[model samples]
Target: MKNIFSPIEQIDNLDAKVIAGIERLATLFKSSLQDTAKRYKLTPLQAQLLIFIAEHSTKLCSVTMLAKEFSVTKATASDSLKTLVNKSYIEKVYNPDDARAFSFVIVDIAKPMVNELTHFGLLMSSSLSSLNENELIQLCHLNLKMLNIFSQSGLITCRMCYSCQYYQQKNGGFYCHLMKKELPAKALRLDCPEHLKSS
Candidate 1:
């Protein structure tokens, strides 16, 4: 029996080692988010929803999009949104494109809490800061490539530049035709408001 959690020396396969490393990082993120959520008296999902609504555009903050983004059922997402609304952390704005639909927006009163909630990723960012600039760029590229593969397989939905129709690979670099700008490897976005699925 092979265990990826075994000592580094015991895991000879590089791919398994990488998976183990990612598992460890996932553990760290979960713990951090849980701790923050507890401090604010919010469920992990509610805290996550609040933080995501603060960061993303309103159009992407609806129950349907939130369900897809968080891999939760629409009912679960809607319930969480209701909790946030009750807590006065978010408000529903009628969608202009669809009057029957409403999207969420963080309320002014929750700005401070959202600022604190966003700190959940601070430690991970600090850890990555130890790498050289080139290494950071390379790591970003690798992560985007891996995310694209997962998105293509329908394992998860990602609104990333690499999967957007406007994304272009030119002269061994990246360009966004919609933005009409060259994207440095480090500037590749994991989420963009204007992302459109590529055919």
Candidate 2:
């Protein structure tokens, strides 16, 4: 296996260097998450669960769904949910659509913390401040391309609109081919359960 964090100079190809940089950035971001989790007296998985529930819509916030989204087993998802519930960070409620099912809701006490965690990327914002708007857009495209490659390799899966086969762009607007409806750019989901990998 290739060492993703090897020194950029040692890499002969520019693309390889860029991939290494992305890996390095991800490492640093995860380190930040670990630090934040430590301060809040929660495990990293617990912190991630809080963020996931906070970001997802109520209908999509169930333990079974989370297990699938996070690629973890049902028992692992239940354990993490249990920890969050015990800490009063989230609560399970009966699913309105299915009486037999339940979903999670972030508690009021956790709202502010969840908001803070959402902006944790700000820790590395300064490093990207030098990039202009066009550069940022280009970087975004490159990152998406790399994400697709990783997904193909079974290294990771992203449920973002751009990664879903349902995603479509038409007449300067976005649409969901699967849903057969026009979708607003702002409404694009980051953790959609309906996501199907683009071919």
Q: For each candidate, C-alpha RMSD in Å? A: 2.0, 4.1
- In Å, residue 32's CA in model 2 sits off its true spot by 0.8
- Give a tens-digit lDDT track for model 2, residues 1-199: 3565556454676766776776777788788888888878877777888888887776667887788767788999899899889888999899677888999999999998877775677758877999987787666665666666776676665777787888988888779988899976456665577877687
In model 2, the Cα lDDT at residue 50 comes to 89
Whole-model Cα lDDT of every candidate shown, in order = 0.88, 0.78
Score candidate 2 by TM-score against the native: 0.75
RMSD of 2: 4.1
lDDT for model 2:
0.78
What clash count does candidate 2 reach?
Answer: 0
| 63 Cα displacement, candidate 1 (Å) | 0.4
Residue-level lDDT tens digits of model 1 in 104-123: 99999999988887786786
Model 1 bad stretches (over 4 Å): 1-10
Q: Give TM-scores for every candidate, taking all chains together and pairing residue i with residue i.
A: 0.91, 0.75
How far residue 194's Cα lies from its native spot in candidate 1, in Å, is: 2.3
Span of ten consecutive residues with least summed lDDT in model 1: 1-10
| Model 2 regions more than 4 Å off | 1-9, 13-16, 152-155, 163-166, 169-199
